[model samples]
Target: MARLTILLVVLVAAMATAFAPVPLSRTVSTTALNGQTRVEVKIGEGEPIESALRRFKREVNKSGHLMDLRHKRYFENSQDRKKRKIVQARIRKRLERMNARRMRQRRS
Candidate 1:
């Protein structure tokens, strides 16, 4: 009878521990330099790592930057080289702004 009570207590404790979820960061980002893509993801704070990664992958895929790269190179010719530099500069500027915003939030 004592052994049965102990077993029941152990089972309940194990079950409680097993169902507990680890608290995780809600913000995740992935930057692909080759593709010139930076994705910012938010999953409402406390989502699992798996969910964050999945959402990151989905955002990257949906960004269309990969397909844009396939159809177009950042620089293909002399004329395009000039334009590519301009476009690249613009993209870099945008990413810098985003990074700054993230930093500001982190500080707070």
Candidate 2:
């Protein structure tokens, strides 16, 4: 009986871990040239788009924001600007995907 109880407990623990929800965070990368730099950010799952984006926008626009173009003159380079645009597009796409996922989850 003791062994059976232990086995049941172990099984439950394993199941919980296996089915646990995974929370993901945003990823950002940055590089600089002689006069300009580039930054990239990738968002992950876990929260609604509005909240995640609000956090992102706040951080990006903050005075010390790592990717701030004005603060980081090196990032003002044309190449760096292009990379920033690409990263921004990725962020928007991620938001759309997140919304779709949430809707599907709600339906189920």
RMSD of 1: 13.2
- Going through the candidates in the order shown, the clash numbers are 0, 5
lDDT of 1 by residue, 1-108 (tens): 999999999889878945666434545556678746788886665567698788888877888777677747554777876886799899999999999999999999
Q: What is the TM-score of each candidate against the true structure?
A: 0.31, 0.31
**lDDT of model number 1:** 0.77
Candidate 1 shows a clash count of 0
lDDT of 2 by residue, 1-106 (tens): 9999999998998888556654456554455567554454456755577876776666555534454645466537788778878998999999999999999999
Runs in model 1 deviating more than 4 A are: 1-36, 72-108
lDDT score, candidate 2, position 1: 100
Error of 1 at 65 (Å): 0.5
Error of 2 at 96 (Å): 1.5
Worst 10 residues of 1 by lDDT: 22-31
Let me know the TM-score candidate 1 reaches against the reference structure: 0.31
By summed lDDT, the worst window of 10 consecutive residues in model 2 runs over 62-71
Question: Candidate 2, 108: how far from true, in Å?
Answer: 2.7
